[model samples]
Target: MFMNLLRENKIVAGILTILRLYLGYAWFTAGLGKIQSGAFNASGFLGNAVANPVKGPDGSVVYAWYVKFLESFAIPNVDIFNFIVPWGETLVGLGLMLGCLTTAAAFFGLVMNFSFFLAGTVSHIPTDLFLGFIILAAGYNAGRIGLDRWVVPFIRKTVLKGKEPAKQHA
Candidate 1:
């Protein structure tokens, strides 16, 4: 029911536009800061996350597998992280802000949010994750007020081979 409203209601779409802009601004600033900081590096951050994976009440790592994966893959490839983290955030922010490929942008945003959560950093992630899910749930309506309004239809018509309805003879 709520999802229907989000997907079909213009009022809800307007509200979503506000949410999208807010999240986009947040991401843009964060990424821009990181890019501007010549000394920015993910090595220390990734190492800390691996060293202190979120612990359960019993003091065991809640996401042991994730921790191991980070150790094996992420930690060893800090250089790649150095490039991906900042630029990815920037691109995601731009996509969300422009309402272009909104679902994909929101999806990636949620992925980053979850990654941060799993890394035991609980800042604005919980709120961001919830909002990101809402944006994703809204689907096409989420981008209705922005570029997706045109881009989605273009893709459907050109790439997906959507056909126009036939006109009746008068």
Candidate 2:
């Protein structure tokens, strides 16, 4: 059954691969810029900026709902978070480009986009596109033409074979 589904979904896998490549390059370029400009520390407007509203669990912000949400979890100096964000983007971009762990890469891309979207920076459209890309990666069979195809099948055959029905139907 699963093999039939995989056989029928070649086009979907291709499209997902293309989407992965495009988003991967986009994310890689963005992260590259941050690395070049030394902005990964997040001293810029978005990262360094403090979340306003200063809510006290009452869900009320003087400015915007988004601000309140930010105040709750968007504290700055997040040095560890800052350090990982850009590198994570870069690695995810590479993974997408190479079609290795493509689904996981897309998942991280979606998360990064969600974080940006929550910033209310008017780039939600692309973020939405990224989210869609993640869904596509999860739904389609991208492993056939990618590393996942080789690795996952081996794992399934070796590890999951025990769970499959016997040749004699038991």
State the displacement of the C-alpha of residue 77, model 2, in Å, after optimal TM-score superposition.
4.2
In angstroms, the error of model 1 at 133 is 0.3
Candidate 2 global Cα RMSD: 6.3
Per-candidate Cα lDDT values, in order, are: 0.89, 0.61
State model 1's lDDT: 0.89
Estimate, for each residue in 26-109, the C-alpha lDDT of model 1 and write its tens digit: 988889889999677998989999887899899988999989989999999889988888888998888889899999999999
Model 1 poorest ten-residue lDDT run:
161-170
TM-score of 2: 0.66
In TM-score terms, candidate 1 sits at 0.93
User: Which one wins on TM-score?
Assistant: 1
